[model samples]
Target: MIVLVVTACPAGLRGDLTKWLLEVTPGVFVGTPSARIRDLLWDRTVALCNDGRALLVYSSNSEQGMEFRTHRHSWVPTDFDGITLMMRKHPPSEAKRRKGWSKARRQRAAYEAR
Candidate 1:
C-alpha cells in the first residue's frame, strides 16, 4: 500500500498525487487529509490515520471503506502513527485467505455430528 500526504491549500496538486497513483499504482487506496499529516494512500485495504480527520478516499475492499469516526486529538496521532507504521512494516490483506468451508461442507459436518 502507498501512503499519500495532501494539502488543502493546493487544489490542482491534489489530483496530481491521485494521477501518480493511477500511473504507478493503479490499485492504491487513498485516505483523506488531516490537520497535520494531510493524507494517506494505501493499496488494497483501508489505511487508518490517527489524525481524526483522516478520510478514506480509495479502497479496493468495500467493507473497510471510508466512514467517519470521532477520535480525540491526543490519542489519534499515536494510534494513527502506530497503525501506519505497522501497515508499512507488515502489510496483509484479509481477502487473500482461503475460502474455508462451503455450504455443503457445513451441512455434512452438521449431519455427521448429529
Candidate 2:
C-alpha cells in the first residue's frame, strides 16, 4: 500500500493523483498500486509540485515496514542508525530569536510604566 500527501499544490495535481489513488482527505491519498505505477505517480507529482511540498509513504520490507520520501519540503528524511527520521530545518539563530520585545511584551511594559 502507498500513501501520498501534498500540501499547497495546484488543483490539477490533486485531480490527476485522484485518478490513481483515493483521496481520503483534502491532501491525502491512499492506494495499493504496483511499484511501477507508484514511481510514475511520484515522478508526476514532483513535476507538478513546483513550489509545493509532497510526501510519499509506502509499505516495504525495511526494518520499519514502511518508507517515506519527500520533495520540496523543509523537513527532510534521514536515516539514523538504520532508522528513518524526519529532521526539521530551522531558520538562522538571529531570525529564530526576537531581537526586541514583542508587541504584547511592549504593551505590557507600557502598562507597567503607567
Highest lDDT among the candidates is held by which one? 2
**C-alpha local distance difference test of each model:** 0.36, 0.94
lDDT of 1: 0.36
Pull out the clashing pairs in model 1. Answer: 1-43, 2-41, 4-41, 29-42, 32-55, 33-38, 50-80
Candidate 2 lDDT, 88-108, residue by residue in tens: 887657565758789999999
Q: How far is candidate 2 from the true structure (C-alpha RMSD, Å)?
A: 2.6
9-75, model 1: which lDDT tens digit per residue?
1333344456444323332224444423333232211223322222233223334432232222121
| Candidate 2 global CA lDDT score | 0.94
- Residue runs of model 2 more than 4 Å from their true location after superposition: 93-96, 99-114
Worst 10 residues of 1 by lDDT: 69-78
TM-score of each: 0.21, 0.82
